[model samples]
Structure formats: C-alpha cells, structure tokens
Target chain A: QQQVKQSPQSLIVQKGGISIINCAYENTAFDYFPWYQQFPGKGPALLIAIRPDVSEKKEGRFTISFNKSAKQFSLHIMDSQPGDSATYFCAGWADSWGKLQFGAGTQVVVTP
Target chain B: DVKVTQSSRYLVKRTGEKVFLECVQDMDHENMFWYRQDPGLGLRLIYFSYDVKMKEKGDIPEGYSVSREKKERFSLILESASTNQTSMYLCASSLWAGGGGYEQYFGPGTRLTVT
Candidate 1:
C-alpha cells in the first residue's frame, strides 16, 4: 500500500504565483517529512524538510506546514519562478536510516 | 556538502545479461540507498546499506541485489536483465542522525534500458 498520498498529479501556475503540494501519510510512526525537487534527466534533490515536533518550518520562499494530528504536510513555494518548474516529491520515513515511503509526485510548471 | 556520483548516465543491456550499477559518495555517510523511479511511482527503494558490507532489502528487492564493500561506494546488481527492469536508478547517501531524522543526498541517476 502507498503509505503516502500526494495531490494533484500536475500543476501549472504563473510566475510570481504560489505553488502548493500536499501530502498525507497513514503511518503515524513517520517523523520526518522531506520534499525533493527533480529536473528532467536529473536526480531528485532535497528542497526542504520538517520534523513532527514543529507545526511549520520556513526557509526563504519554501515553507513546510505539518500537521501531526491530521497526519498531513504541505509544501508551499512562494514567488514561483520558471526555474522552479520541476517534479516535486514528498516522502516520509519511519526512522532516519529506514526505508522511505514516497508520494506519487507532483509536476509543477511555472509559466512566465 | 555531499556529492553522490553514478558511474553511467545511460546504459543499455540485452535480456538475460548481467547488469551492474555503481554509485560513489564523497561524504562518509553511514547510510546508502538504491531506488528505482518510474513514471507514476515516485521512488521505490530496492536496497539500502547502513555500513560497509551490510545490506537490507527495501520495498522492491525481488530482481535486485546490492553490495557495499566500502562506506563510500554502493553497487546494485541485476542477476538477469529484463525489459521490465528498465528504469531510472538513483543512489542516495545520508549521515545517520541518532534517530530517524536525517536528509538524504541523491546522485544524478542512471537510466538503464534492457532489450
């Protein structure tokens, strides 16, 4: 079973707009929520991450809002730019060294 | 900063052929992982190693095996290549936090095609 579910599959937005991706998990044991960004023909890179202790964490224009009670987390990219257009994936892990469960992925396209 | 490098960007192998994918990391991270990425499936872990010569199976490990002779290098071996095994393989490494709260750095990825 897919422990993590993400939506929508794809998203399109204008430059300067906000791009938001949401993820939910069924395993309460998962404590780490990390977002990865990938360009075509490239590997996924870490964008932002949050722990369950914090309800929200923000870094520059990227923010991760986590809800432990609801078992959900979302990534908000503010001031989206053309360079930011890539596939985004949110993953959760039960332990730091354990296997990770990933979402299907969200393809974000930012048009100028 | 940590850097992960894969041996090949793209490769092609014939069916029933033996295939090997190699990954190397600069940092002395204790954890190394191998994952396969497909169109709909985001990333599925095939195997992971916590230390040298130690390996564990991931979500999908049926047709794959892994080796880690050193802390910085991890290898994935396909006993027999099949068309269905064609996919983008990614290697990742992470410094183990005391608990399960560390981030993993990924390699560029290797695209493999089996005919």
Candidate 2:
C-alpha cells in the first residue's frame, strides 16, 4: 500500500508536443506529491510538486494535475524539447511522514 | 540550495570486499537518506537518519548498514560486497518542514560495480 505505481516505462514525444506521465498510489493518506527530473549522469532534481489541497499546479511549462479522491497524480510537460529528454520520477508522502515512497521512473525521449 | 555530496562518483570492487559510501549535506537538515537506483526499480530506500547517531531501516535494508556520526554526514556500508549489490547509490537530505513541502536534494550518485 506504500508503493507509488508509475506507468509507461518509456515515452517518445516530438518537439513542441505535450508529454504526460501518470502515477497512482494505494494509500489515500499520502498528501504530498512531487516530480523529479534526472539527466544522463546526474542526480534527480526537484522539478514540480503539488499537494492534495489543490487540483492542479503549474509552473512555467511543467504542470502537475493531482486527484485526491483517486489517489493519483500526473506530470505534464508543455512544449517538450530535446533537452527535456530525461528520466522522471514521481514520489508521495503522508502528512508528518518520515520517508518518501518513489515510483518506478519513466524514461522520456523528445525527438527533434 | 541544499547541497548533498557523495564521496565518490564511481567505485569498483570485488566480491567479498567491504565498501563504504559517504554522504554529506551542508544545510544541517534533520533528515538524511540512502537509496539504490536500478533500471526498472526506481529508487529504493535502504536507510535514513533523522539525527546524529540515530538511524532507521527502510524497505531494502538487507546486506547493508549505515552510520550517522554527525548531523551533516551519513554513510552506507556494505559488509561484504556482492555482484548483485552493484548499483547506482544515491544520497539525499531534507528538513522536517521545508519550503513548499518536504523536498529531497540528491547527490550526483555513486555508481558501484562489484565484480
């Protein structure tokens, strides 16, 4: 029940297209959700995050659509570019939680 | 920025050898974590420390141990390195109450290869 399941192990998108990745969790207690981006050899970086309090949150070209009742969340990348090609991970945690549970990553490739 | 640094970027070892991966966070955060990343299995937490001299086991803690002597430093130890233990090890840190929310800052990761 602590696991966060992510789908589409790999994705291919064209430049200037929209890229979407989905993740769902079994634990409804999870309130904090965040997405991370990792380059070829670097560590994953915090890109965007959303809480159950809001339905959606957007930052620049990256947006996170969160559904509280369904216990699911998604990351949408607008204007996908080659540089955006990387591995993305979704994670979740409950309120006053100690550890964060991560999902199986999605390898996104944006072709020019 | 929360700076999390690992001791090595790449490490090669033989089976039965002991290995130690060190991690340090500059921000003096209360929580530190160690994880292993594989192809299909994203990141699995091995251990974490909430404060100096305090540690907790995570999902996959078998064949691994950790040490947190100081607040800013956390170490993952392999008692006897095995071929299957070869993986990309990551270290992260975050505060109890962080900006926006609890966000982890990861290190560049240490790629360990046990032959």
Candidate 3:
C-alpha cells in the first residue's frame, strides 16, 4: 500500500499560471516532507522541503504548505514556466525509520 | 558538488541472463538506496545500505538483490532477468543525520529492458 497519496496524476497549466500538487500521508510519525523534481531522462532533484513544525516554507517560486492536523502538504509553483515542466514527487521521512516513503508522483506540464 | 553516477544509461538483457547495475557516489554519503521507477507506480525502493556490508530490504525486494562492498559504491543485481523487471533504476545517496532526514542526491538512472 502507498503510505503517501498524491492527487491529479497529471496536470497542464499556462506558463504564467500557478501549478499546485497535493499529497497526503497517514503517518503522524512522519516529520520531514520534501518535494523532488525530475526532468526527462534525468534523476529526481530536491526542490523544497518543510517540517511539521512550520505551516509553510517558501523558496523562490516554490512553496510548501503543510497541514499537520490534516496530514496533508502541497507544492505551489508561482508564475509557472516551461522550464518547470517536469514530474514532481512528494515524500515523507521519519527519523525512527530512517527511510523516505514517496508518493506516486504528479506530472506537471507548463505550456508556453 | 555531490555527484552520483551510474554505470550505464541504458541496458538490454535476455530472459534468464544476469544483470548488474552499478552506482558510485563522490560525496562519501553514509547511506545508499536502490529504487525502480514505473509509470504511475512511482519510485519503489528495492534495497538500501547504511554502511558498507550492511543492507536492508525495502518495499519491493522480491526480484532483486543489492551489494555495497565499498562505502561509495552500490550494486543492484537481478539473478534472472525477466520481461516484467524492465524499468528505470535509480540510485541515491544521503548523509546520515543523527536525528533527522537529510537530502538525497540521485544519479542519472539506468533504463533496463529485459527481452
């Protein structure tokens, strides 16, 4: 069973619009949440991350909104660009387990 | 900069043949992981090693085995290549932060096709 669930298997957005991907987890033990971006033929790279201690964390155009009460987190891309078109994965990690549990992933296509 | 490199970008093998996928990291990370990427299924971990000569099974480790003889190198082995095993293999390395999750750096990945 997938520990973390992601929504909208795929989505298309305009270059100047916003792109949002949501993920939910059932494990309260999960304390670290990170988002990874992967381009075609390349490996996934860390984009942004947030801990449950904070409600939100922003880095440039990417922001992570975490809801500890709801066990949900989302990535929002502001002013989406064609360069941002890639597959994004959400993952949760707990120090006790020392491993990351990843979501199914969401493919975002930003069309110019 | 942290760099992880795989032995091959693409490979093809026949049924019943043995296959080996190699990964090497330059950052001297303490942990290494192997994962397979399938459409819609995402990245499923096959195995991981926290140190040399130490390994742990992951979510999907039925058809695969891993070896980490050296600190910077990890290898995934398929004893008998099967068509169903065809997928993209990714290797990642991360530092061991005592009480928290650290970032993982990934290699380019190797796409394998078993015919």
Candidate 4:
C-alpha cells in the first residue's frame, strides 16, 4: 500500500510563475514532512520541509504548506525558474520510526 | 556539512553473481538507509540500520541484505543479482532521535546494471 500519494506526476510552467505539487499521507503517526529535489544522475536532495505544528514554512522561493487534520501537504515554488525544473518528491517521517515514506514524485519543467 | 558517499557511481554484474554496494558517511550519523529509485516507483527502501551490527528490513527487502559492522559504513549486498535488480541505489544517513525527527543526507547514488 502506498502510504503517501502525490498528484500531477508531471508539470510544466512558465518562468516566473508559481509551481505547485501536492501530496497526502495516510499515516497519522507522521510528524515531519520533507520535500526533495532530484536532478538527473543524482540522488534526491532536501528541498523544503514542514511539521504538523506549522501551517506553512518558506525558504526563499520554496514554500511548504501543511494541513495536519487533512493529512495533506503541498510544495510551492514562487517565481519558478529553469533551474527549478527537476523531479520533486515528498516524504514523511515520525520520531523513532527510522523509516521514511516517499511519494511517487512529480517532474516539473519550467519553460523559458 | 553532512556527506554520504557511495563507493561506486556505476556498476555492472551478471545474473546470479553476487554484488556489493558500499556506503560511508562522515557525519557520524547513527541511522543509515538503502533505497532503490526507479521510474514511476519513486524511491523504495530496501534496508536500514540504526546502530552498529544492527539492521532492519525496509519496505522491499527481498533478494537483498545489509551489513553495518561500523557506525559510518553500511553495505548492501545482493546474494544473487537478477536483471530486475538493475536500478539506481541511494544511501542516506541521519541522526538517531528517540522523539525528534531529523533530515536525511543522501549520497550521489550508484547505478547498477545486471546482465
């Protein structure tokens, strides 16, 4: 069973536009949510993350909006650029669990 | 800075041959994980180790095993590699916390091919 589900497996947006990717989790035990950016031939790297306690967390052009009761979280890239074109994955982890559940991932492409 | 390093960036092995993938972390992390990445499948965990000499099966552990004799090194072994096992393998490390969550640091990944 897939514990975490992501929508829009692929996305295309214009430069300087907003890019959004959404994910939902079934495990209520999850407390921390993180997004990862992966480029070709490289492993996934940490992008942005949010906890259930916060409604939103932003790091520069990247933002994570979280909804605890809904079991949903979304990643938003403001002023998306060509460099932002990469696969995005959302993952969840709980304390002492030691295992992280990942979403299927979204391939985002930003056009010039 | 946290750095996780995989021994090889690419590897090829024949079917029924044993294959070993090595990973090392310089961050002194207590938790380490192995995962395989594939198209449409995202990343699936194969094994994870929380302490030296200890290991646990992740979501997909069939045909795979792990060794963690030391805190900084974790190894994934395929007793007999199969064609289906060909994929990109990633190693990650993180701090162990009983009640708090920590981010994972990932290596560059190894692309393995089984012929």
Candidate 5:
C-alpha cells in the first residue's frame, strides 16, 4: 500500500497559469513534507519542503501549503512556464524512520 | 555542492545474469539509499545504509541486496536479473541530522533493461 497518495496523475497548463498538485497521507508521525522535481533524463531533486509547525512555505515561484489536521499538503507553482514542465513527487518523512515515503508522482506540462 | 554519481547511465543484461549497480557520493553523507522508479509507481526504496557495513531493508527489498563497505559508496546487487526488474534505479545520500529531515541528493539514475 502507498503511504502517501497523490492526485492528478498528469496535468497541463498554459504559460503564466497556475499549476497545483496535492498529496494526502494517513501517518501522523510524519513531520516533514517535501516536493521533488525531475527532468526527462535526471533524478528527482528537492524543490521545496515544509514542516508541520507552519501552514505554508514558499520559495520563489514554488509554494507548499500544508494542513496538519487534515493530513494533506499541496504544491502550487505560480506563473508556470514551459521550462517548469517536469515530474513532481510529494513525499512524507518521519525522523524515526529515516526514509521518505513518496507519492505516485504527477507529470506537469506547461504550454508556451 | 553534493554530487552523487552512478556507475552507469544505462545497462542491458540478459535474464538470469547477476547485475551490480554502483553509486558513490562525494559529500561523505552517513545515509545512502537505493530506489527503483517505475511508471505510475513513483520511487520505492529497496534498501539503505546508515553507516559502513550496516544496512536496512526498505519497503521493497525482494530480489535485491545492498553493500556499503565504504562510507562513500553503496552498491546494489541483483542476484539474478529478471525481465520484471527493468526500470530506472536511483541512488541518494543524506546527512544524519539528529532530529529533522535533511535533504537527499540523488544521482542521475541508471536505467536497466533486462531482456
């Protein structure tokens, strides 16, 4: 069973439009959440991360909105660009486990 | 900058052959991990090592084993290659900060094709 569940397997958006991907998890022990981005021929890299102490965290055009009680989190990309097109994955981690549980991943495409 | 390098970018092996995928990290991280990425399945952990000669099984460890003889290198071994094992294999390394989640740096994955 997948510990973290992600929605919208794939999405397309126009340039300058907003792109959003959401993920939900059932484990309450998870204290850290991160989003990873991967290009066509490369490994996934850390894009943004959030802790339960804060409701939202943003870096540049990437934002992570987290809901502690709801056990859900979402990533929003502001003013999406064609160059931003890639696969995004949401993951949850607990200090006790020392490993991340990843979602199924969402492929985002931005049309110019 | 943390650099993780995989031995091969692509490999093709026949079924029933033994396969080895090597990974090395330049950051001297204490934690190293191996994961397999497949379409729609995301990345599933196969194994990880926290220190040299010490290892732990991850979510999916079947048909795979790992060796971490040195702090910088982690090797994944397939006892006998199978067609079903064809997929992109990724290696990652992270620092062991006592209480919080540290970022993991991943190598440009090795795509394995078993025919």
Candidate 6:
C-alpha cells in the first residue's frame, strides 16, 4: 500500500503566482516530511522539510504547511518563477537513516 | 559537500542483458539507497544498504539486486534487463543524524534504457 498520496498530478501557474502541492499520509510513525524538486534529466533535490512538531515552516519563497492532526501537508511556493517549473515530490519517513516512502509527484509549470 | 556519483549518465542495453549501475559517495556515510523514478510514478526504492555487506529490500526489489562491498560504494544490478526496467535510477547517501530524522543527498541519476 502507498503510504503517502499527493495531488494534483500536474499544475499550471503564472509567474509571481503561488504554486501549491499537497500530500497526505496514514502512517503516524512518520515524523519527517520533506519536499523534493527535480529538473529535467536530474535527480530530485531537497526543497523544504518540516517536522511534525511545527505546523508550518518557511524557507525563502518555499513554505511547508503541515497539519499533524490532519495527517496532511502542503508545499507552497510564493512568487513562482519559470525556473521553478519542474517535478515536485513529497516523502515521509520515521527514521532518516531508513527508507522513505514517497508520493507520486506533481509536475508544475510556470508560464511567464 | 556530500557528493553521490553514479557511474553513467545514460546507458542503453538489450533485453535479457545484465546491467550494473554503480554509485559512489565521498562523505563516508553509513547509509546508501537506490531508487528508480518514472514519470507519474515518482521515486520507488529498489534496495538499500546501511553498512558494508548489509542490505535490505525496499518496496520494489523483485527484479533488482544490490551489493555494498565497500562503505563508499553501492551497486545496483539488473540480472536480466527488461523493457519495464527502463527508467531513471538514482542513488543517495546520508549520515545518521544522532537518532533524529535527516534528509538524503542524491546523485545526478542514470537514465537506463532497456531495448
């Protein structure tokens, strides 16, 4: 069974708009939720991460709003730019040294 | 910088051929992971090794095997390549975060095409 689910499969936003991607999980053991960004022909890289202790965490233009009670988290990119057009993935893990279950992904497109 | 390097950027092989994808890390981390990424399917774990000669099966380990003979190197082997195995493979490594959760650093990736 898939531990984490994400949506929508694809997104489109204009420059300077907000791009959002949401993910939900059922496993309460997962304590770390991280978002990754991937450019074409490249491996995914860490974008932003949030621990369950905090409801929200923001880094630069990237923000992660997490609702532990809801078992859901969303990534928001403010002032989205064309350079941000890429695939985004959300993952959950209990032990950082162990395996991480990942959501399928969301393809974001930012048009200028 | 924590650097994970994959042996190949792109490779093409025929069905039924044996394929090996090698990954090396420079940070002397204790954890290494292998994952394959497909469009609309995200990253799926193939296998992982926490220490030399110690390995574990991930979600999708049916057709793949892994070896970690040295601390800094991990290898993913496709015993017999199939078209379905054609995907981008990524390798990652991370150190233990004092029992706390930590993120992993990934390699550029190997785009393997099994014809």
Candidate 5, clashing residue pairs?
none
Lowest lDDT 10-residue stretch of candidate 4 chain A: A91-100
Each candidate's DockQ: 0.81, 0.65, 0.84, 0.76, 0.87, 0.77
lDDT of 4 at B17: 100
Question: Candidate 5: TM of chain A?
Answer: 0.98
| Pairs that clash in candidate 6 | none
Local accuracy of candidate 4 as per-residue lDDT tens digits, B1-99: 999999999999999999999999999999999999988888999999989999999999999999999999999999999999999999999998787
TM-score of 6: 0.96
Q: Please provide, for model 6 over B43-72, each residue's C-alpha lDDT reduced to its tens digit, 9 standing for 90 to 100.
A: 999998889999999999999999999999
Per-model C-alpha RMSD: 1.2, 1.6, 0.6, 1.1, 0.6, 1.3
- DockQ comparison, 2 vs 6, better candidate: 6
For candidate 3, give the lDDT of residue B7.
Answer: 100
Candidate 1 residues B4-115, lDDT tens each?
9999999999999999999999999999999999988899999999999999999999999999999999999999999999999999999977678678899999999999
Per residue, candidate 2 scores C-alpha lDDT tens digits across B1-115 of 7799999999999999999999999998999999999998999999998889999999999999999999999999999999999999999998877433678999999999999
Question: Candidate 1 at residue A102, lDDT?
Answer: 91
Encode model 3's per-residue lDDT on A18-104: one tens digit a residue: 999999999899999999999999999999999999999999999999999999999999999999999999999998777899999
**Least accurate stretch of 10 residues (summed lDDT) in model 5 chain B?**
B94-103
**Which candidate comes out best when scored by DockQ?**
5
Second chain TM-score for model 6: 0.97
Where in model 5 is the C-alpha error above 4 Å?
Answer: none
Query: In model 2 chain B, where is the ten-residue run with the lowest total lDDT?
Result: B94-103
The DockQ-derived docking category for candidate 2 is medium
Better of 4 and 6 by DockQ: 6
Cα RMSD for candidate 1?
1.2
